[model samples]
Target: MTLRVRDLDPENPADLDGITAVLRAAVPPMLVTPELLWWQSARAPAAQCHRLLLAEDEEGRVIGRGSTGLAHESPEPGLAFCNVYVHPEHEGRGAGTALVSAAEEYLASIGARTAFSWVLDGERNLGFARRSGWSPSRSARFQRLDLTAPLRPLAPPPPGVELRPATAFADDPRPLFLLDAEATADEPSDVGTELDDYEEWLATSWGHPLLDRDLTTVALVDGVPAAFSIAHTDGADRYSSGMTGTARAHRGRGLAKLAKHDSLSRARAAGLTEAYTSNDTENAPMLAINEWFGYVPAVTEVRHAKPLG
Candidate 1:
């Protein structure tokens, strides 16, 4: 069966549905939707040069999809990423390879010197990356919690600390952005990211379609945003923690836990039944917090990288 690769058309409903279906089948813990896919491809910063690639068989069915882009926010330049996902039933049909090749060519064309990808931790997936000349770097685990289960009672916020919905800062989100920037800089990862562009963050994060401000919880200390747990919902039963972080000064104060617990409770109250989150294997603090929240390990994916000419 001959296959062809092409850029995704966000305006095309069929394209949106096809890619979303493939992603959902390939990675069940992930929360994706047609609207989220559209927003990612359309609102990405220009410097990132983001492209959503689709692999179609001769029958015109989208069997695989790839998200490729530059690590524009990294302090280091010439870094690019391409994460490809193929429907389980279609995995051995060369769709994943075709999508990756097409993605690399595009990244190289845009001045990228190295490409990175996340491969599910399985012999088949790892073998594919190895054959493609990529080497393992680090791994992260996806976890899930049954929000319908009984949650441990949250303790009262320490004196001078308050738990509030992120919506409270709707009038001005710059404070949240600042805290996010600080916390994200400390996240353990192979590719370091610097969230310095406030405007870009506003466009890609603050204005994102899935950001549920009402469900997101923030910990405030003396009226200052100290830590936060950002929430993303599919407008259905699925909920994901986009990010949870605490400011440097707030470290060891349990603010991150406070924020995430409140956020998860709010999500459950809002009718979200499943909650999902991911943390790098080296991030013991966040992992411990999630475990305390009753999140169990779901799957792990290893980050792999290859240099390009």
Candidate 2:
């Protein structure tokens, strides 16, 4: 069957559903929806040159999807990402190769000097990356919790500390922004990111379509935002932790763990059946916290990079 890759039309409902289907099939634990895909494609920062590409067969069925864009927030310049996911049923049909080639061509056209992709840790995936001239760099773990199962009870905030939902700061999210920026900078990754753009963060993260402000818990120390567990729900049973971190000054205080427990409790009470989260292998603190919460290993993916010349 002849295959072709093309840019997705975010405004097209069929395209949105098609891509969402492929993504859900490829990464089941991810909290993704048609709306989230639309928001990512439409509201992506222009500097990133983000493109959601779709691979279709001659029969016009979507068999693969690719999300490619520059790492504009990285301190290092000209770094780009091209993550391609082909529907499992369509694997080995050349869809993955076609999508990757199209994504690389686009990245290079936009002045990218290097490209990075996350390959699910497996012989087939690793072999594909190697044959495509990409080498493994780092690995991250995806974890899942059966929210329907009993969860650790939420602990009362210690004296001088208070827990609040992220929506409480809707009037002014700058405090949460500051905490997120600090935590994000310290996250382990191949491409280091610096969240220096407040307006950009507000647009991309604060106002994201899937951000469940009510489920996102934040801990305040003496009325100062010290730790937070950002939550994203698919407006259904699926929920995922977008980011969970504590300010540098509040480390070892158990604030991050507290925030996550409260957030998970809220999610479970609100009928979210499953909770998913990911952590870089180097992020021991977060990993430990997840394990303590009864999240079991789900899958692992290795970051692979290739030079663009």
Candidate 3:
């Protein structure tokens, strides 16, 4: 009847699989894999104090997991984060509490002044954060579309723009990386991140295990990447938009829409049927683009923040 939290070892077959299993059991809709998990752990920034911890039962079965990391790259400092989840079947035990406590202690030790976590916006989930002193913040909605559904045909690219696959830039992904940095700096988030490290960007974003280069579409304006839709596929029937964004200068020209539409079409052509994306409720431009693509709101996740002394 003992419950304890311990650091996760990505190299350990049992630990890695068990962690991914717990995540899948707790949040089935999100895509996670042992390989992707390990890759992230390997390439994470050292200053971030990023750690993935596992909660194990008496029999050595990992039933819960949590991820905590410092926002090292964010322009706003002192922000750390943790999101703990337990298998529904294993709830009511002390695993959740143990993991959360461990996470808070780790972040505090690293001088994190504030912590942010996403707790599903529901009575039960919100109740947990509230009881723990966390307050509600902004909310986001998850949307899904059936790739098999009839989609509004995307009009041909504008005069000087053309659709290009991310794979085409395998020899040189720096352009896409730059575009990603510019777009992400503006995305709605509790944390403000500005990507500045090229190597880190290559390791974390361009070389991610789940990112499907061929399925990712970029809109090139006169040979420069102006907008892009990053895609991740499960190699099965599902695909998701990791991010879709356009540079500031490219706004109002339907470039983000064009890139995403092109990526969705490519995903469907690749035999993926279900596609999903998430958007902050206030991001009208992205929300509108998703709607145009037939993506309907499937779930909503609320962001919860708590300041620690």
TM for candidate 1 is 0.99
Per-residue lDDT for 86 in model 2?
87
Q: Tens digits of per-residue lDDT for model 2 on 1-309? A: 899889999899989999899988988877789998999999999999999999999999999999999999999999999999988889999999999999988888889999999998899989999999999999998999999998877668889999999999999999999999999999999999999999999999999999999999999999999999999999979889999999999999999999999999999999999999999999999999999999999989999999896
Candidate lDDT scores, in order, read 0.93, 0.93, 0.88
Error of 1 at 60 (Å): 0.8
- Identify the runs in model 3 with alpha carbons over 4 angstroms from their true place: none
Enumerate clash totals for all models, in the order shown: 0, 0, 0
Q: Arrange candidates by lDDT, descending.
A: 1, 2, 3
* Tens digit of per-residue lDDT, candidate 1, span 1-309: 999999999999999999999989888999999999999888889999999999999999999999999999899999999999999999999999999999988988999999989999999999999999999999999999999987899888989999999789888999989998999999998889999989888888899899999999999999999999999999999999999999999799899999998988888888889999999999999999999999999989999999987
Misplaced by over 4 Å in model 1 are none
Kindly report which residue pairs in candidate 3 clash with one another.
Answer: none
lDDT of 3: 0.88
**Residue 201 local lDDT, model 2:** 93
| TM-score of candidate 2 to 2 decimals | 0.99
